[model samples]
Target: MAETEKSGNAFVETIKTIVYALLIAGVFRTIFFQPFWIPSGSMKETLLIGDFLFVNKVAYGYSYASCPSLRLQRFGIDVDAKDICGFFDGDNTRLFGGEPERGDVVVFRHPVSGRDYIKRLVGLPGDRVQMKAGVLNLNGRPVEVEDAGTFEEVMEPQGPQRIRPRCANGAVGDGGMCIKERQIETLPNDVQHTILNIGPQRVDDTGVYTVPEGHYFFIGDNRDNSLDSRVPAAANGVGFVPYENLIGRADRIMFSSAGRSMLFFWTWRGDRFFKAVQ
Candidate 1:
């Protein structure tokens, strides 16, 4: 009887420890940082498909969007951020809010789909943004973009999604060399970053978009492959994201994996560990 009681006590202690650990982790994620996994090539060379980073929640202060949304299809658990902190939304305000500067890479909730998206903030409130002839135009001036050779990669299934990359060098067989024209784009704020172009697309030329108050404009580093503020939300694009939807800014990549699973230690990208996000 004594042995059984000891084993029961140990089990109870273990469960309590797990519960306390989970609560601490939850508070950390909600208040300070949020773990974000790069699941797409939209940001491309700047933020790859397998990059893992922690978003600094305190960067833009707190809002309803700061609350984590738990969605696990396999577990049948689907909880939206609004479900947890919906009352804090709708006013277009934040707690201890700070304005996000142009050219910062940020993660936010999609206004329509409620999915989290990471993109480079390009247009601020009251800014006129447009894409004319493959060049980004801000306030009627074309942003500087200089050719920087080509970005090359192997043509193969990437990450768990198995999504193949779109190449400027046309269709490529598996394991073949894939290429995209690379350019160094300088935002108005003087922040420079690499952008990949895959020839011309409809989004390359768009009418002027006047960013509304309390909203922001974002775009992907992979210009031709992204459906961002260049398209409207109704058309399956990001459109103008509201300020309250802003979650946090991604400062640096904690680690990166080039394989389908992070457990595949052999597929880790050593150089990208602790790499600063440009």
Candidate 2:
């Protein structure tokens, strides 16, 4: 009986050690290096639904890069609560880094409902941003378009049948197919990036907006199909994120999976591993 008790105790101790190690690893991952899984088509060609991305939480600043431009002094500290839901304590954590550059990919808390989203920076404070004929214009420069190619998007089937959009015989932007091949280049500051255009019409193109100080103007690369700053703050979209909502920067794409669901790991798209974010 004595020998059996010793063996049981040994097994328990071994299990305890393993559990503790795993718990610590989880803490490190969630705090510093979190693995973000793409769940929607908002980031289309750049990031697929099953693509798992690793975000560098320390790139911009602390957990919440709430500080103003790395140009201005950081916000300093949290003195009051914000939002009715109490989502975040509004702790104005500051940092001494440079402001987010034009082409940097950022993650921030949505202003309307406090949800988190990933998007590319398009306009800085005091800059004019507009989307006309499906092309994003900064200040006065028209973003150039390039045909990168097509992608198979798996989305919810459209609603009931209705009068289809009239098709004119010409290039897409000129008026042709519904969701055809289209691309454009947006020059934010001096950095340029590829933007996919599905069509020439979008409801988000309300009008020109001048990004206010202490806030940033953002939009998704998949212009034709993303809910972003274009929507008013009253509509539940991010309405010019304040420095307090800045999360971090997407430094790289760790891995991506194609058609297959995230459940099947053995069939992951091995070719996408270690691809740098452009």
Local accuracy of candidate 1 as per-residue lDDT tens digits, 1-278: 99999999999999999999999999999999999999999999999989999999999999999999999999999999999999998999999999999999999999899999999999999999999889999999999999999999999999989989999999899999999999999998899999999998999999999999999999999998887888999999999999999999999999999999999999999999999999
Best by TM-score: 1
Off by over 4 Å in 2: 1-19, 64-88, 91-98, 147-179, 265-267
Q: How many pairs of residues in model 1 come into backbone collision? A: 0
Top-lDDT structure, candidate number: 1
* Candidate 2: residue 117 Cα off by (Å): 1.2
lDDT tens string, model 2, 1-278? 99999999999999999999987875665456656666555665566556677777666655333321111225564332132224534554445434777778887777756556888888888888887767777887766666666543323221122112222223333223444353546474556566665556555366888898867888887776678888778876666877667667777778776534555577477877887776
Model 2 is weakest, by summed lDDT over 10 consecutive residues, at: 157-166
Stretches of candidate 1 off by over 4 Å are 1-4
TM-score for each model: 0.98, 0.72
